[model samples]
Target: MLTINKDKSRREQIESVSIEQLVPHDHLVRKIESAINFDFIYDLVKDKYCLNNGRPSIDPVVLIKITIIQYMFGIKSMRQTIKEIQTNVAYRWFLGFGFSDTIPHFSTFSKNYERRFKGTDLFEQIFNKILQQAIEHGLVNMDAVFMDSTHIKASANKKKYEKVFVEEQTKTYKQALEEEINKDRQKHGLKPLDFTHEKVKLKEIKISTTDPDSGMINKNEKEHQFGYSAHIACDKNGIILSCITTPANVHDSMVFENLFNKTKKNAGKSKRAALDAGYKTPPICKLLMDEGIVPCMPYTRAQHKEGYFKKRQFVYDEYYDCYICPQGQILEYSTTNRKGYKEYKSDPKVCEKCEDLGRCTSSKNHTKIITRHVWEEYMEEVEYLRHTKECKELYKERSKTIERVFADLKEKHGMRVTMLRGIEKVHMQVLLTCTCFNMKKLANWIWKKGKGGPGKGKNLEVLLEFFSKVVLAIIKPHLSFIEKWGFVNNLKRAFARFSIFGVLLTFH
Candidate 1:
């Protein structure tokens, strides 16, 4: 009763008759193609290369597109990108590859990026283009844009980063000094605890390292890390508006307001700039309010420490230009400065009889002084934003809006660190990375906009139609002896490259 016969379930075959019909079709590659200024980029890079007598610039359009295609799929190395392009038929088609062609080598890409077109304003152009395009597409929501900062970890150059002290004038921990001495001795011939090359940049010698001025110590903080901090701005759709990098030692308060102002031109309709406490300062507050930006940042928690009178407790008399203490004590105005700031010192007589002296005054002479930055209007407004529940919700949105772009740039593009050194060199490198990033994003959008993704034979049929139109227009007489339709389709397999097949063979 057990059925063991595994017979072939064969179906009958029948002879078939062939049928053919002429169908009307036309190629409209123009409509599906993106409206990017590839020619402008090409012209710009070409001009730069001509100025530098650069190595063969492989049609800047093609080179940029290839680089972008690499980025879209997260390919890290240029060499691998070249190989992929040379092999994959869809990739080849996207890059306008003709049969029997070759991709540019890795070295060419490196040399092009490193030496030529280094400081060109290409990134700004690309960024501007994207912003403009997003504006056109109504994708950018500039209403009360969110603000945040993400630390991009730079590539480590062992020589550039070393033990550095806070407050460059020699007052450092014994362990720190010893570590510095050890570093100098192991690398340079300098002796221990000498302070020769510490703060004194001698003409006779400089810190001999692979990178000369990669971000150095803050000298005022416990953490002695030396690198750059990127202040990035983005719209609701997560496209970058602007970015500025400063020495890691640069106070976040100083750069915070400026970053907001720098991105104003790119803001489609934004009115508020929100950031963290790292950007809070008196001068910065004044600058932001003056520029009509409703700046929002949380007050520093240090003010609420166990043993300090928070600056918020000090009340100012704009009429008398002085500070009034809580104990009905009048602090005399010390000076009226050009910065519109006035400093007030607590009356010595009042402090002499104050009840909470220890909790309030730590001054050497029992004098408590407070300086009014004269920009309290902005501070008051910003402080209000911090207290409200709505602003709190807005602040939470900032991380997703802008930080995602940074993650893509760092984790995906392998640009977490600068490949170069020195402030100028690093700036250029950053601009270049941003430029490449935007181009890649634009190219990806363009590739996908053509009815389907270019990587999936989206344009192959249209390509045949294009060639057929061309043949009908000019080459029909020459090909009359051979009557054939869809000739490009017939030629596809014949001309297609098996380089990718070779790649498959290698794995096999």
Candidate 2:
């Protein structure tokens, strides 16, 4: 009963085994293979390929697929991904490679990316293609978007920084910001302040020599570290619309314009945007309002120090253009400084005998002053929106969308630390990570929801019929009408046609 069967290895003849049979039908690789269209990579990389010169290149599609697999499975390095792909049956199946097909060397990916795809928009195009598919499937809600940024540790040590004096860069929105400030003041019956003479000041900084593009930043009470910040904007459904990377020393407010513009381009007619207090600046609120997006910003933390009366206690009187203090004293407008702050000062003579002088001010003049930005009203408008029911609900989704995205990027997708130096390379990593995320979500959505229940497949039939009609309608239009229309008119017609297509497709 305890005897073991020992037999010499015999070569079996004509076995019925197949690579496809070795892979489970329900495997994730199979799902990805069916859900994603890899053909687009051919077009995306076409220009990089030689038309009639040199040896035939390895398929760029396979190379991209390998990278996607690496990120999807959280493989830490290209070498590991290559080894896994060579041994794994499902991976080989997904990649359209035979078991005996030679996997490319690990250096192949890095070399190809540097020589062919670096500094190109191929990654962005792929990302947008996947996101567009999600949009068609009704997985994204662009009505409201959430924006936030997170820091990723760079490939440099903190101690490897050099101190140097750096000139402050001019603000890109300086002219627009000043114009908005003047308009806001004019609305409140105040004269426009002079901004033609504003001067910028330079400051000293610590630059990292190892990763020169990375910036030295300090968060909370922690020691300074070299890192980069990734600002991301996502739809209410948690689909990332855009991602922008900057040095960690870059403030959220400084990068708002570029990030907002990119998100707007991809988000498709968003009605509102949710942002953290770091984005609660006056210019940001005005920008959102100007773009017809209601700003949902939380209450900014009070700036008053302890033992000082809060500025709210001193209410502004529109009739007198002054602040009414708690002790019933007029704090008249003193001056509009070059920095665009309207400073109000109280009467020291009246305050020297006040009963609550200790709580009011400890200045030798025994008076208090308050400064307000010219665009404070816009900020107040955003603050008011924060307390509304709609805004409160939208703000609650921030954690569910942008925050969770960052958590997944850092904790699961190997984005917590930089694998490559330089901003360009880091950006490439971010794009690839986001593309993989969108791919995973797309696969899950399609597999779980792409097929309707029971007779609902008939709905797909009707949908196909509707698109056929749309094409017919567009073609049936007169050639004379097309010739008579300009580019804008053609764009409008295209949009109208797509709207009709969407209605019919969603007619379940």
Candidate number achieving the greatest TM-score relative to the actual structure? 2
1-508 per-residue lDDT for model 2 (tens digits): 6987676454555576789999986678776777887898898889898889998888998999998888877787899999999899999998888867898999998999889998898888988888888888888898998999999899998898888887786676778767766775675677888877766687888899999999987878767899999988888777888888999988898898898898777757689999998998878887889889999988776887698789889898867778989989989887665556778999898999889889888798687887877667888788788899999998988989999999998787888888689999888788888888877777777776645322335686678677768655664455455446644354455555555544533322
On residues 248-344, what C-alpha lDDT tens digit does candidate 1 reach at each position? 5455655655666667766644767667676676566666676676666765664555876776677777677667787768787665333334457
Q: Which parts of model 2 are misplaced by more than 4 Å?
A: 1-16, 180-198, 451-508
Candidates in order, TM-scores: namely 0.65, 0.83
C-alpha lDDT score of every prediction, in listed order: 0.59, 0.82
Task: Give the lowest summed-lDDT range of ten residues in model 2.
Answer: 499-508
Model 2 clash pairs are none
**Model 2, TM vs. native:** 0.83
- Cα RMSD to native, each candidate? 18.2, 11.4
